[model samples]
Target: MSVDHATMSGLLAGLRVVDLSRNLPGPFCTRMLADLGASIIKVEPPEGDPSRPLGPLFDALNHGKESRRIDFRQPTDLDQLREWLVDADIMVDSFRPGILQSMGLDFDRLKAINPKLVMVSITGYGQHGAWSQRAGHDLNFMAMSGALDQMRAPTGELAMSNVQWGDMAGGSSMACIAILAGIFDAQRRGTGRHIDISMAHGAHAHLVLPKATATLFAPVLGHPPGAGEDMLNGNLPCYNLYATADGRHLAVGAFEFKFWKAACAVFERPDWVERHWQRGQAPGSPENNALRDDVAALIATQPLAYWAERFEPADACVTPVLTMHEAQAHPLFADAARTQPWAAI
Candidate 1:
């Protein structure tokens, strides 16, 4: 029951949190708060958090918290649950809409007990909508929101599934932000508020950039992948991925005209400066393909180390395409070794 005095020194230092949901978003949001020194008591429905055993990434995320995965099926524990919530400052949940209400921890009841409580509910959709009651995960949410359709490869292979594109992208991130805002409002207004978070809404929010690409810029650019077909998505001479001689890869992310000019100067490929890789054109057309091929050949002439030496000094965003393991060993990431918990975590 004692708090870690030194550990609880961050901004959210004395806050007590009750995390009642499982899986990604709920845990991720609370984990972030916990990192800031909040006292988080994860209250699972007796079976433990589903994400606790989710592997390498889970180990990397779930740290600095007290977990009591006690099954609430037993009648005796509900009394203890009430005791835990009576003074808890925040409650974070991710059950689909009404599932928590059915279990009897709905905001109304908790607010009655602790009027200043901040109840955060992160669902696939929102509290009320046609799809509000629908069952979904990150992929389904993103798929319906049109966020996924807009993230396809130029060649249009299988749809990519970057897990938590919704759950973490803005769902948990937004939930955490709302909870913090609610906490501040409760302090100033002397009243609590229920935060009904919608993962679908958050996931859709992540698509703002891509969605505008289609709706806003499609007219000028002639649609297709819209802005996706623009220089950034593996379609331009100045910005794309290339293979090196040792079968390694490097990433070039220059977007601004000046940066593009710098990349050209770096490679002594000034011919690429005025090449005009306007969007909406054929991806591998004769001219574009030749530029990509030439860049590929130019990079392939040297090993990744040579390219790293070449690019690191230029401060261009150009970088070696490091494998996951290689990335951890990278000098930039390796400097973390001296930074205590960040490196350890």
Candidate 2:
């Protein structure tokens, strides 16, 4: 039997999710589920979600979902919530480790009521970790995961991005994966599961490639790369950002030999064609640093418009850095504007 409800027809059409989470992570997860046609019941306290004051953000995250106001202090309200859970396929929450247990909404108790409920708890740390009960946010999670340390400029200055990597990628996206996997398993075995998602742990998992590179090449390199010293980060001349004459930036991603060759042709520096990683050139070496300086100096001779026009038809893997407004109006994002309703927000 299809778990889909008759009114909808997406992948999660008939799934019912009870979202007792407020801020970003839990709400964003449920929002993605709702987009796939799941019915989301956003359970909020009488005071409402803390994000409610953030008008556009709140609308973007909670749109198309039913809102239910419940004060756990009231026995009737709590009982009503339990009644809702009886028919819920999934329950998502983002409280500290033992907050749900104190409110009598623990997984053990809820699982008895709804034997097929897939319960998911999201936190900055795992449920049983020493820092599980600690109060922290996305930045703290990124810092703890070592991912933030990698976000550095060529000058070794740490750069803070507006993108909440920990909240969205680690917490929201991981919770969605856990929910779907749990649902599949429960349908097969007729038993529910509790998923513990740590945002910091998920963020750390994204460092797999960098971690492997650091470990595998430590013997040859004498030491692991730090901050912007890694190949993909900013150490390589073939793949780095450069400033143009107008102070605008251009992203040069000519990592492969062919792309580097093409970029060198565009730069009118055919001599730089052989000074690439494929030709036994070590990144961050004295020769490579000199090559980077030469490349930067050449790029600085032209404005962003001139280089953008030059690279528009070349297979050099180079592009002008664009502002958010420019990106939104770009042709590449045309389909996004039509399909993603929240793209405007």
Candidate 3:
């Protein structure tokens, strides 16, 4: 998915950006910007943006960007930052709510430097919420937002699968989109804007489903976090995972009658379809459990490749759970020779 430099000329050709954010969310936001040809000058303090030395993401995210090492507290450094801020089309940062104000880089002050600048400020709990000053990240955000209660590890402990699931996927991803939207609005209105992106709020956006369900049902029902008891929390058989004989897995997501019948047909067990298909209910019911057992037995007879071959061609949602290595080189992506211009990585 890499792009050649020449082919990326006019995407964001003349945009100048000053990035003051450190670590994951801000850098990831800027990385997407860099990918589109924005000239981003990442400003860091004397000690440096922590992510520059944060071992993992350097080579990948910071590839096409430049850095400006300056102590924004010092008079000269402030002068230089002001110069960049005054001229930049957009400025981004991930400081806490009032820390930017304390650091003399607040949006009001900086916007005064360049009224047309689109200022994006990202924070954990947002600027003026009850948990505004509270320290938080992905796991905490997920826990608070109800996105974490559904996933449990084999040990019965709450699973925190990937770090920054909420931070990057929720927070950083949302911030980048909001920033782009602000830029578009500025382009149309002829006046730049100040965007306050709350990482917690971004994380909270993922709670729409649970929140709506809880609200809709709260009058008649109860809250979630009931584990396998909750409706959409993998409590049913038709929408759950089954373990194979070799400890591999299969995702049986036959959430509808049509898909359920297709799955049963694919497994050559049509009787199980209507018997186990509780389309509107959750996973642990007798019908779903029986179907789960059937699928478990059927899929374990062969390896993942064997199952994929039969099911993939049929467009059955029944899929062999892929490992990390298998996913990158999977056949789904091995069609470079078939596309019009052919694929280029």
Predicted model with the maximum lDDT: 2
lDDT of 2 at 95: 90
Q: Residues 1-345, candidate 2, lDDT per residue (tens digit)?
A: 322332333668889999999899999999999987899999999999999999999999999799999997887998999999999999999999998888899999999999999999999999996898898899999999999988888677888989999998999999999999999999999999899999999999999878987986677678887765787887789999999999999999999999999999998888999999899998778998899888999999999999999999999899999999888787877543244433211
Q: Estimate, for each residue in 57-105, the C-alpha lDDT of model 3 and write its tens digit.
A: 7656666789879986787878788887887998888877888788787
RMSD of 1: 4.9
User: Which runs in model 3 stand beyond 4 Å of their true positions?
Assistant: 1-10, 153-156, 212-225, 230-232, 276-284, 331-345
Clashing pairs in 1: 46-70, 46-71
Model-by-model lDDT, in order? 0.75, 0.90, 0.73
Candidate 1 — which residues are off by over 4 angstroms? 1-9, 54-58, 215-217, 224-228, 276-293, 337-345
The order by descending TM-score is 2, 1, 3
Best by TM-score: 2
> Model 2: runs farther than 4 Å from truth?
1-9, 336-345
